[model samples]
Target: MARTPTASAGRRSRTKTVLMGGVYVALLGLVSLIIAVAVATAYLPSYGELTKRSDLGQMIRVRAANGAVLVSLGPSFGEWLPYAEIPAEMRAAMIAVEDKRFRSHLGVDPIGIARSVKVRVDSGRWRQGGSTITQQLARNIFLTNSRTFGRKVKEIILALAIERKFSKNQILELYLNRVYFGGGAYGIDAASRRFFGHSADHLSLGEAAIIAGLVKAPSNYAPTADAEASRQRSGVVLNSMVENGFISAAAAAAVDPAEIRIQQTTRENSVRYFTDWALPQLDTLIDETSDPIDVWTTLNPGMQAAADRAIDAHTPRGVQGALVAIDRDGAVRALVGGKDYVDSIYNRATQAERQPGSAFKLFVYLTALESGMKPTDTIVDSPVTIDGWTPRNATRTHLGPVTLREAFSRSINTVSAKIGAQLGFSTIADMARRFGITSQLSTFPSMVLGTSEVRLIDMTRAFASVANRGVAVTPYGIRKVITADGRLLYQHEQNEERVLVAPWVAAEMVDLLQSAVMGGTGSAAQIGRPVAGKTGTTSSNKDGWFIGFSSGLTTGVWMGRDDARAVGNLQGGTAPARAFSAFMRVAVANRPVEQFETQVPIPDWQLTPEEQMFGDVAIDGNVLESMVDEDGMPLDQPGQPPVDQPFLQPGRPGDPSQQELDQAFPPQQAPPRANQYPQRPPPQQDPRSQPPANPSDPGAQLP
Candidate 1:
């Protein structure tokens, strides 16, 4: 129909306006498309001619404790296997559990992202991850696990590039070979060999599912150790596979727990214990150096071999033992943590805390000697009661009166308890701590009977301090850590704190310990040279220990069952001492016979009137009264807890090996028993002095 001229003009103008707007919108859309293409191109990597890169550049070469080449390790702990060898079931399981639409997506999945976002919104927390298998592979290869926007963007970009560069099969192969599968295994092949004792291509369906489950959390779902968790996670994977059409529901249900067989892989390593202890220290260096490093340790191959031999010869079947030998300077020369490192990797030498038994008497006696008590002084060896706790001698009989040296030699429990009460339990604990004991100590009377637990390394370190003539010692294995290019990373420097004990006290203790080996429970440790040592057997013989030292070396040996089962009447003198003797015989085969410096210049061995009174009070069961207030009443409440004392200072400033051997290990010296005690130092206020106050008094404080 014909319209008015003005109306027709209006219609034409509106049409022209609509046309212009359409053109503008089209231009804007084309520009946006061009910009998006440019950005994607910039982010993409070169794909036409892929340069094969090696993953071995990050390998680390760990040296033996003695600086010899031990082994080289890659960033991952297993050999890489090609994708062609990975089981088809494993590939399907990974795809099902990790990325359901992996075949359809370019790199990422929008559906998965939207689902993860909905989960976070509904739960009000970001617990779910939407990362596809491609994104994870890209992160594993080119980025770290940092959760930042920049890293996530780079991960996405790399994933896209990887998809463009390699086929879907290649991407899946790389993921299978590089993903961790628990037990320090890095790939499918390594995981299969470690868990199933077979090749990747030979993996059963259940085994493959188990391996796939571990990729989520290795420690929590390892099939070998966490079998139940692995089973449950594998069931989840199988369900996902059924839903994704990778497997039938009936087939997925057929994967039985009983059908999954895990073969025990052979992992026999002689230095495994030492390596287990050294690896953590190496990791610290790796974090600092960010490169391969070499660790020079103090372990001696000869001594280590001898220790292994000693354990094998002395320990019976099913009985385990640990041995640690250190020089006077506290450098660990040899360490054997178990009868066989292959059977177990639990480091008993540094990890297990067992009763020292009579071996603990060393600290008790040392404490008494440090308090100005003479070795020849008498201590009544009789059963005594303190707060209803009575300690009896192991022999079930006690001599009426015995000298301190004789009491220590015989390891008389009653006498040790009496002395511990006289000096106070805190003093003994302090002395032991000063000697490098880090284990928690008991302050009860039973502590003198070795009721407390101690690590073998600590016990050995304590003996090492005595062997060094009261020099402070820190038992250490790492000598130095350097990079492959010789850049220094770490060095064990000797500390210069004053020795916690006096030289005279250490010498006297050495003399008494020497007498112990000569005529006491540790006689089995005697090796034709002057040896100072002690033997200890815990209640029911659950733990047997012989901690001894020669002029040149200090060593500790222990024999026990890991379950704390009694070893049929095994005493410290029988097996542990023999082991110590055997190890020392090989350890000192080339060194000349050296004598322990047992003589320190002192006055005649005579008890002072105060000491004699203290001894009498100890014998009469009035030990606390003897250390009484002026009113003849006990100064301390019966059940008052002991206060902690300041630890002993370090030794004189010098090299740990600078001590004169002439004085440290003389070839010929007077018998320790013949040497007289030096005149006691001028008496001063006891460093342990404190104000008398009620323990329950809130205002009372220990200083």
Candidate 2:
């Protein structure tokens, strides 16, 4: 084992050569790895890709007349926020929780990654995301949310590329706007509005903390779902901010998540019917190629809430209903297409065409008045037969001779049919067309009784025309369209209004409608103000409708089953008129009492001995409380609806209703969700609003 000095020297030289060779190989691998990273980073998405906007599409954000977001179609990215408009607290809170070294890091934060690894090892779970704000932005825009090693490498490369191409502020904006805040909300503006009821610009320190805390697990912490969990998460975010020197301990200590003011919402799901009805008109209102559009509608949230309340209160279970409220100018204030949107999106208010029953008498009487028949004129209410068809009054027995006003107020079917026949059915059809009733007309002898099916909107518009003093009312919902940044794209300009009737005629009609409410079937619709309206119920109790106006607001209500089956004991004067009263009470609460545009005095009419027995019959709920006689057989009352069948099948040639056909051959539909259209929601409550103990956030799918 003894070695010579020369051999020992040689062994030392070999060892030094091997150590130097190993050092050279290590340096070569490091340079190659650096080159590989540089190449991958260079190939990452370009600056425009990282900075691309999710709102660039023709996204439609539907809003209430008061600028409250109602619903959104397509990408529901909240309105964009510039770097300056982004709240300082929002920025600080997010950075303090998500990445402490975001301000100093180039793109990847090694310290954050190391800390995340240690935390994961210690806790045996992922406690921190470890990615810097830039990296998160890259992953959100370019890469998927995968934990694969290849994905991590690509995320780092893209993050470096993003940091190289964009400033830190730009990266922050992208990340904040792109991050999901749960409950379908995206972006701080939307998340803040969804949870805090205000925009991010107005976010308080507590609110900012709550929103920042959602990044870790949006679904788990959304205040709309669990206020306590969200509040706890907010505390964690506040503590992190204090630790990071972003906020003082005293400042964080003063915050209470429960005190955050969240906007109270009613049953807003029904408002989507308004949006669906208005969305189609967007293409006609403005260029479809414009930037993201903010569609301002004439929908009054208060009125909408009122309508929802009324429907929920009056509409019984297993029955569907719809309501449409419009201003004098035809600005649709509130529209409920159906009882539940998710159960059936088939909008009964706008799309369903069913027999309007006595509601159609508006046209017949309008024609009679236009033909110079005064309300004081004498008319016979006895039975009549025409073209081998006989129509019977709802009472089965008719009052002999009654004043025109009396017959109209009592919803006398024979009187209207006689007058319509005398004036010619063609003339009545012309009058219906003149007043915005667009559905097909049967024009037969019984057609004057609303035997022909018509759309609720058309029927509502006709009554609106009468309330508007004979000016045609086009029910419009969309008020204007604008860009996200408040640039005007379209402003609704009403078309020239055609005079459908002389002012005096309109006054005469108003007088007639007023008489109906004052002393007839519409007695239940009084809303502490003079109301002019008519109630309609189809045979077999298939449809119930009430169309009326009060305080310059005209509202129409329709209740029916989609399958057109009979609804037991439900009539226009009972449920529909009651709902109308409830809705108008809220709709006109603020407006000053408004009188009829033109009030032509009604001449006091002398009633016959027989008619005198039923004189002053305009008692409250007069028609509703007595819908049936002693035998319990269906009583045929004008607005209350008679159970008798029509003279002829209401559907003749050219009156084929697609709604009926669809009902006959029901189309395939997915079963409604378990909670969709939950049984008669309590009045003044949102069905889906599952606010936690704090109730800081109502469950509105924000984004």
TM-score, candidate 2, is 0.77
Model 2 RMSD in Å is 18.7
Candidate 2 local lDDT, 1-703, one digit each (tens): 8899999999999999999999999999767656766776677666566444653345677888998878766654566687899989999999999988888988999888899899999999888778888888777777788778888887877787677767888889888887878766778987887776777887899899999999889989988778889998999999999999988999999998778765544354788788888888877877656456788899998889888889989997899989999888889999998878888889999888899988888877777775557777888888887777788887788999998888988988889878865667766776776676777888678888888888888888888877876767888988888887779988888867655665557778888888888889889999888889998988989999899998888899999888999999888888999999999999999999977754443211322332322223221112233644788554664432235644223268755476765655454454544233213224264221221111122321111
lDDT of 1 by residue, 1-703 (tens): 7799999999999999999999999999667645644575466545322222234244344554655544335543344456676678989999988898999998878898899889989999866668899898888767898877788777776777677767898888778877767775667875876677667887777887888888788999987667788888888888888898988988988889666877643222555676566657665643544454556777777787788889989986788899998886778888889977767889999999999999998888888877767677898988798767898887899799999989988889999888776777767776787677888998877888888999999988888888787776777777787764577878877866445566777888998999999999889999988898999999999999999988679999999999999899799999999999999999988888888777665422233434333332432123445466686643433323122322222364542342453444333333334222222222263221221222234432111
In candidate 1, residue 189 scores what lDDT?
72
lDDT of 1: 0.75
What TM-score would you give candidate 1 relative to the actual structure? 0.55
Point out where model 2 deviates above 4 Å.
1-59, 74-88, 103-106, 110-129, 167-170, 183-186, 197-202, 597-703
Name the candidate that leads on TM-score.
Answer: 2
* lDDT for 532 (candidate 1): 88
Q: Each prediction's Cα RMSD?
A: 17.8, 18.7
**What value does the lDDT take at residue 274 in candidate 2?**
86
Give the range where candidate 1 is weakest over 10 consecutive residues by summed lDDT: 686-695
